[model samples]
Target: MTTTFDRGLALLGAILDAELGSAGYPGNAQLAARIGLDQATVSRMLKDLAALGLIERAERVPGWRVGPGYFALAAAAGDSRLLVRARPLLRGLVARWHEPAWLSVRSEGTALTVEAQLSHWSSYVAAAPGARTPIWCTGPGRALLLDHTEQQLAELLEGVEFIGGGPRAARGIPALAAYNSADRLAGVVVADREFEHDVVDFSAPVRDPSGAIVAALSLAVPRFRLADRTAGIAASVAEAAGALEVGAL
Candidate 1:
């Protein structure tokens, strides 16, 4: 009862998993060997995947890897769920704190905003959905790192350029490690004027039902408004994030 389409889809999935496991792009023969398919069949299926934008060939090298279309599909499916579930919660944060709130998830080593509730305040930092900020420089980014291992941290920081934004912006791995340690212990992170000198970001991790970190919920406000209320703001964000996890279940 196996249809040709089903078999083709299975092959595509196998090829994609193989490519994901490889360090670099794989050639058709390499993929065929990995997936136990003949070279000619693998080549034909690769062409089909390329046409569907599920896989792409390297421009400068004779190899293949997963393509942007795969990521787009993933984001649409997964991020949309998170956004929908977090919308009311983000709105609540804005309503309660009178500050902009954001929901972000890690994508390609950056914190990609998927949802935002802008503050009614005249002077506010506006962040549109799909805006990307470096993981090394944002509160949500550091909060996302709480689950990363030391080796993962090194890999993430490798070759990343550090730009100064505030007095507390971490300049090197040692400082970043220190920040991560403290944030992990506290279950939240506060970046005071880290991205913008006038902006203070408070963030807490959003975990899935299985206790894996899935995203971060954060609030951004003018530094002047955040004076002496860091703990309270962090607690609110953490409470909202916990509500999101419960809703997910």
Candidate 2:
């Protein structure tokens, strides 16, 4: 017979594996169905996994993101334990901007939403806290790429499929690679094809106590709607990133 921890670990792995394979992360019910378990049971295991410091469970309105912290921990071990450290500031940014904000990590060359915050106005499929977006197609993804060396960036992009038309999205990888520290400006545009609009995504890197760009903070504004609010948009996202840098994340 399997021990409780072993069973919980197995169940947690299934939920996270399914999440990784999905276009976006799935809800508790869907994860339950996939694992042939009940939602509450899956939730408990998820909580346990988080307790073990092996995973993160993002409980959002539409769904929850079961991300790979166990793998993250395994890769970096006890050194990179500050993911939970960034949640509150991300929350504050969402509250201040009344918009969706996210904390995401690049896992296995794929960008994963490890945490999310929603403004009161979130009713669309745009930027749910737990949703996964392509590193090749998103502003956060591009900003996240800026921290890599030329070879790493090229290798990371190799054979990668891209999604686009976001308000901040550049026309190609060359544009993305052009992002600089000089402007004190950073972010990307992702085409909001689902809503038939462009979403301006402004992003900045988040470093843990070790100062590694382990995650990013981003804001997605509707392009047509944000023409008048550009400065405020930039400031809010920059402020959010700054907040994370000072131990917020």
Candidate 3:
């Protein structure tokens, strides 16, 4: 039986799907059409869900996206052992540095955040699990791609448009390839104002027992706040990544 609760859940799931979609977030009209509901009904339902914190208005964007509550529920229900193992490490990163920390894995040529530990600051970067970012640009994103060969990188990035990031973001595959080469040598990635103009990210790849790159652990901070502290922050991210790798296995 199609109950009211099921319909609400369906709406929430649809919004989350669009939030993670490469095509970008869907507005009310689009959501209504997709769900086969009247625009007025979708709007009322969205308002109710937003009030409950299941979804929210996308920041500076034109549509609805899943909220922290949704992620909290999803995390509780998820069965991934790695996510279970990573939560403490991410929390530790936040507790130590007072910065947001994230655990992300490669998905469909993008980096999909699977876990996040947010800082307690009144103003800080807002990232939630299920958010996706360009694999060629962001810190965790680049770290996730550190093991790919030049040809493999090219193949994966084929048809991808390099757009909508801060000034330092890689503008092309060649730039990403160069950055990855350097990251491979250094064993970490520092995305300085690459994903967002005011934020910087330090990340390291997390490898499994078989030495395969499975995820990336990252710490994000404001660019101004990172002054003269880059090295220590990068080292901490790398160390935490190592711990997560062992703990996950």
Candidate 4:
């Protein structure tokens, strides 16, 4: 018993899932052919999708892909559960390190902050939820990269624009590989003024019971205090991540 409404929903779901798997946006003609719909119908549906925030045009190109609306809905559902378990731990990290603590998850090819607890200090890094950062330039980004395979990393790096915020920022795949290697060995990653010269970030992976990395827990501190506190900060972040994992289990 399939109604027109059900069929329409199915078409929309197919479009979203197909776009998710695509490395680049497929034009209306391509999508219409794939979905077995007429070009005009697909165009109309795409308009509706765009208006609903389920799809968006690429900023630098003439194509459509998953939009913030989809990510926002996914994040709201997933992050609410994650925050329920990670919030107290993030608060603990902020108290222990006297720095802002953040929880970020993979959003397409970028890192999206889902939760953050600001430090009490007057001068501190500001990371609001939904803030998106490059996957090659931040501690949590690098930490998240540790889960990617070489082929996946290569694919993700293709067409990526390197926006170096400082001398320490990773500008290419080689540098990102080095960072990932170090993070894998140490079980945590540190980015010192990579995204912003005045900020230092220490992050560790938050794993689910099945051992997949679900998010990254990070401590954001001022660069002036990073020299002597790097090790301590890393340890604190790691401990918080461990607690998150335990709570998830």
Candidate 5:
């Protein structure tokens, strides 16, 4: 027999499934239909979940999404052991360079930041977890595409308008391709004043045991702050990424 607890868990699972499955965030009606529950019941349960921070109400849209509490639980329980290992690495990078470090994964056509480490400085580039940035310009975004073929890149970018980002951001396929060529040759992505006018980023892919790119690791520094240490920072970022792959896997 299904218990109340079971039903509650089922509702939560349904919400996550809908979001990850590309059905977008499910509203009360959708959740009600999905889990065979009354709309009122679903609403009450969602309120409870939101209170617990397991989920959050969507902004600018009608639906729900994962919240920081979920990430906290996952990290605490070793559900995402990779991220646990990444925390120290990110800290070390920040300590060494006094720049911000980020861990990201491709979410459709954008790069979704899953982890971030900020420096103590008053002035520094920072991105919080769950922030999404354009794939056509950001270092972490480009790093995630390092293994894709030209055709795969084209297909992924199809219907995506080349807009936003700094003035140097890629405005078309040709420009993106040109940037990709240099990145591919270097085996890491170097995005200079692309995602943000004053920030420069260096990123490398994080691979799973099977040698497939699962995510990207990046460090962002203000252009003025970077000075002459660009090459050193880039190489260190790449090395740290490799270490993450090995240690996590």
Candidate 6:
């Protein structure tokens, strides 16, 4: 099972491990050249490992250290979510927007909000921490599919209910555009259409140490506030998200 692809990856990982021991984990550009890879390839591999839970890191570092998830895969196991590390950052986002910020993870075609807090006076999502959202048509669901291929997106959305509203459960491609205006996963946004909620959302993709966007940070607000503070709150939230994204590394 260890193909050439894996070997190339192993070399890259070794380079990082070594650098961390010496240079304190330099940027990807330096690591790539040391490992005989170009910068972009190093970035791609880092994202791959981040998605697989082998490592996690922030964007500012330009490199990965390690993900808390690694402990789960080791012979001696610990928590799987790595939530403890994410809480402080997620909580700060709530304070930034004064609205409920949802913390979620995807599993078996469903997006589960594991943490919920309201920054505003009222609770919008109303979905508790354990709330499960179908991959069909929700902000978090669409956010997860932002960079995926058509088939990959479909595979993830199948059999899920489109409770959040849009075209339909099967036609979730719009969900991607609903988040990523640029049509790529570098960054994304979310707004409600055809639902009673009438909310607008903005989000940033959270990458693990390897540099892959695994989870996402999202904020929800009434459609009115969406336009009102589009520049102010949204920008601040994005900045904070950027901070968190980089901190994860």
Q: Best TM-score goes to which candidate? A: 3
Report the lDDT tens digits of candidate 1 across residue range 58-147. Answer: 778678777654674467456566778889999898888888898877777877666788777623452545556778778888888878
Q: Which stretches of model 2 miss by more than 4 angstroms?
A: 1-84, 120-126, 161-168, 179-196
Worst 10 residues of 6 by lDDT: 71-80
For 67-135, candidate 6 gives per-residue lDDT tens digits of 533433331113233455556666776777677676555655655555556565444562344445554
- Model 5, runs deviating above 4 Å: 1-79, 121-126
By TM-score, rank the candidates, best first. Answer: 3, 5, 4, 1, 2, 6
TM-score of decoy 3: 0.71
Estimate candidate 1's alpha-carbon lDDT, on a 0 to 1 scale. 0.76
Q: List lDDT for all candidates, in order.
A: 0.76, 0.60, 0.81, 0.76, 0.80, 0.56
lDDT of 1 at 151: 73
Clash count in backbone of candidate 5: 0
Worst 10 residues of 1 by lDDT: 122-131
Candidate 4 lDDT over 1-249, as tens digits, reads 145445456555665766678545677887777767788977887887676556778777676777785676476556566788778888888788777888887776777777788777623443656566777888888888887766677788898867756678988777778778877888998888888777888889999899999888998888877778888888989988988888888
Judged by lDDT against the true structure, how good is candidate 2?
Answer: 0.60
Who is ahead in TM-score, 3 or 5?
Answer: 3
Expressed as tens digits, the lDDT of each residue in 1-249 for candidate 2 is 157655665666665676677535556677678667778887887676655345565555455455454565344323344456556777777776667777676766655666677776554533543345567556566566756665676676777544554444445556555543322333333323322245566667766667677677776666666767766767777666766678633
**Residue 159 in model 2: shift from native, Å?**
1.8
lDDT, candidate 5, 163-234, per-residue tens = 788878888777888888888877788899888888888999998899998788899888888889988998
Better of 5 and 6 by TM-score: 5
What's the TM for model 6? 0.56
- The CA lDDT at 104 in model 6 is 56
